[model samples]
Target: MNQLGHLKQFRSSVPRKRSMGRRKIEMKTIDKEPARLVTFAKRRVGLFNKANELSTLCGAEVVILLFSESGKVYSFGHPNVNSILDKFLVQNFLPEENVPKIMEESVQGTKNSQVVKHEIMTELLSKVGVEKKRGKALDQQREEETLLGGEWWQGPIEDLDLPKLNHLMLSIHGFIELAMAKANMLTLGTKNGCK
Candidate 1:
């Protein structure tokens, strides 16, 4: 029955504000000349920006050509359109059926190798995620190494909590198994003849 109660009541009574952000634009032609021109400029800028991002982030070569209502040409390319066009032309000069390609590695053998893989782009993005996880694991390992002054072998079995003890047991089992395997391999030769 005080100012706090009044303030809470007042706050509850007030309506929520609407979001002032981008919304869906109508997919119809603008009849007005000025409006159309403005829209074209804005859309062109957005298109070019996206192309630049695609080129930069994915290490892709891209070329975009746009024409205005008045026949003015607008173009955007990462490493110049002419070079890309030339490469394309050289690769495609002979018809696909006619040309017998020699199975030689590319001079820039990076992107060419991945072209035949299933969902290569998705794989590449997944690799980024894996690298990020690996980087975090590496950082954590470095911190632990700094704290322990070497590989983290937890000491004083009694000091370890239940989960830590369980983890330690698992690690010990793995080490024993690995040692046993190496001992067996040393005593007995492998199927492929161990190097």
Candidate 2:
């Protein structure tokens, strides 16, 4: 028997530990301070490594800003942090001092601007969308009216179905309402209602 064959036989004698594969971490706040700090340190290093890889491999500008619970700051930047921040500030407004404030009012005022701007933009967009839908409905109504050839009252009504006759009756009521509203306005305007 060879020494190599004996070594192979010895390897087959050893047991392997069974595992259920990698587990997905539940995304929740870590209540334990010590574990959280350790996790932060590990994750921060990994994040920085990824950022460095992104810069080196893709030749892209990368900047990361992180604030720890202890008010410590951690940052990763390609080339420099200041240059990227300056470029960002040129595009968007930022405070004179970028430090976090303890004052609720001061911090809230800054935060509120972004929230308000987003809310206003969303509101205006919804209004414009509603206006567009209303315009489209009006256009469809106009097209349907055009298809019926100008005026329904002037068109042939003898061939119309019961439902169409009911619709025409409603339209006639609408016209009566309009005329009455105009008459009422005129009545309010002058001594004599109509002359």
Candidate 3:
């Protein structure tokens, strides 16, 4: 019996470790009734604990409503469920005295929305005007080059005056780039189902 033989014997004699810990479960609707019921109970307790903690820490009113598998209603609320429900109903439903105040708020909201719509329309119109101006400039430049008896880009760059050549190059490049960007944006918008 050498050291290698003793090591081999010890390895063979040792028991394999078994995993006894809880595993991470995938979230989905449970099909088995008994398992679903057990999970529901456990989750309900955890939910109540979280709600209680939130209410205590924030000094805030909290309410939760749930239905069990058997269709029984379960509710959790701080400072009672009925009081919270009554408060919600009163605030949302409104008494006759509060009707005028609600109407005033609604009117103000409408006016604010109208102002926003007007501003957006104005901005869109300004962009359209800029595009129209650019289109006109490009058309004028093309006509001028035609009248000069050939495409400006086709003519020898060294033959033209430096200032005129610089102006032509800048105008053509700027217009073409802007137009291409606008075309690309329009194409993307249509592809994405945008108006």
TM-scores, one per candidate: 0.38, 0.42, 0.39
Q: Write the number of the candidate with greater TM-score, choosing between 1 and 3.
A: 3
Off by over 4 Å in 1: 1-20, 93-195
Q: Candidate 2, residues 1-195: lDDT per residue as tens digits? A: 799999999889999778989899899999999999999999999999998987787666678989999999898888876555544443333344532321232335565544544554587689779967866875687689879777555668897779668767766776796797687656533532223
Best to worst by lDDT, what's the order?
3, 2, 1
Best by TM-score: 2
- Residues 1-195 of candidate 1 have per-residue lDDT tens digits of 899999999999999898878988889999999999999999999999998887776666778879899999898988875455334433433245422221122233445533522243466578769967866866786687678675444466667678656656766786796797687656433332433
lDDT of 1: 0.65
Alpha carbon lDDT of each predicted model: 0.65, 0.68, 0.71
Give model 3 RMSD, 1 decimal: 20.1
Is candidate 2 or 3 superior in lDDT?
3
lDDT per residue for candidate 3 within 1-195, as digits (tens), equals: 999999999999999798889988898999999999999999998999898887676665667889997999889988655455444433444466745544454446665543543454587689779978977987897798789786756668787788668778777888897797788667644653544
- What lDDT is reached at residue 22 by model 1? 92
Global CA lDDT of candidate 2, please?
Answer: 0.68
